[model samples]
Target chain A: DAGVTQSPTHLIKTRGQQVTLRCSPKSGHDTVSWYQQALGQGPQFIFQYYEEEERQRGNFPDRFSGHQFPNYSSELNVNALLLGDSALYLCASSWGAGTNTEAFFGQGTRLTVV
Target chain B: GENVGLHLPTLSVQEGDNSIINCAYSNSASDYFIWYKQESGKGPQFIIDIRSNMDKRQGQRVTVLLNKTVKHLSLQIAATQPGDSAVYFCAENPNNQAGTALIFGKGTTLSVSS
Candidate 1:
């Protein structure tokens, strides 16, 4: 089956503008998580969604929000973006909220804020 | 501010040689750890994972060693190849909770040359 898939492989947004990125989870997976990876750095968790609700969140500000649809697909929305928000946004999906379940990731969307 | 961190930022190895990447995590309660390899323009791919109860775990061409005493985690790659060159990240599930997000290290770039 096809693994997680993210849309708009790359995006360009201006400072103070908003942007939305999309993701489709793998088959039979129900949980989706978002992460931000800056250049030369590992990914930082943003939030996690299960059952169409956010179950857990990271240290990011409220400016970064997300939504998970009934189909288990997800979207990440950033409002009033700043240049510092420019980074690679990754989407990962898992079968459940189990502590030991493996996560499958998609090719991330590269956001460039000018 | 407990987090995962890597010892080295970069590693260079020759083809056919074995390579090891090291990481140190500050969360003593973490029960799960994972290693991921990310190539340019792609998302992080799972390599291997180890549980706190197990000292080591082996995959096809990769191995993960966990030293709970020193809070150390390591990834070993057998017969390094040019295609294996990528930024390797060590991640941990903080607090051993079911829905907790993973915290990742700053990653170590692996470079293999013939």
Candidate 2:
């Protein structure tokens, strides 16, 4: 079974621009979560999607949004990106919504906002 | 707000030695804890996990110990190797809700030397 996969391994955008990142969940998994990891920092929760609906969100602003497809794939969109947005965007997939579930993560998309 | 934190930012050990990474979480209600290893420019990979009900869990060459009384958690890697040199993060599931995101510690950079 394939693990989580993310697209556009790396991206560069200027301030105020919008960017989109994509993720495909692992086989047999139904939940997708997104996180942002700044250099030297741990991954921060951004949001989670299940059943094509956003279930939870972190402290991020409204400019950070996400979508879940019927196939359990996910997309993260950031509008008016700021230099603070430059980080490694990670996508994790889990089998269920419970806290006890194990999660598998993708390689992540590196976003560099100039 | 309950914050998860690490005791150390970096650790170095000989290849044949055991390494321990420590984390402290402020939330007493956290039900699940996870350890993740992230190689350079890569997303975190799940190392091991322990639930609140359990005090310890073991996986292949790794072990996770949880001290609920102090909200302390630890990951022990036996016989550290160069491949184990990476950033290690501990995350806690504050709530089992679908939207509730896992809070992660700052992370400890583990360097295994020959």
Report the number of the highest-DockQ candidate: 1
Error of 2 at A46 (Å): 0.7
Per-residue lDDT of model 2, residues B1-114, tens digit only: 438999999999999999999999998988888999999988999999898999999999999999999989999999999999999999989875665478898899999999
Please give, for every candidate in the order listed, the TM-score of chain B alone compared with the true chain B: 0.95, 0.95
TM-score of 2: 0.97
Calculate DockQ per candidate and list them. Answer: 0.75, 0.73
**Clash count in backbone of candidate 2:** 1
Q: Model 1, chain B: what is the TM-score?
A: 0.95
Candidate 2: which stretches are off by over 4 Å?
none
Worst 10 residues of 2 chain B by lDDT: B94-103
Off by over 4 Å in 1: B96-98
Interface RMSD of each: 1.4, 1.6
Candidate 2 C-alpha error for residue A19, in Å: 0.6
Judged by lDDT against the true structure, how good is candidate 1?
0.92
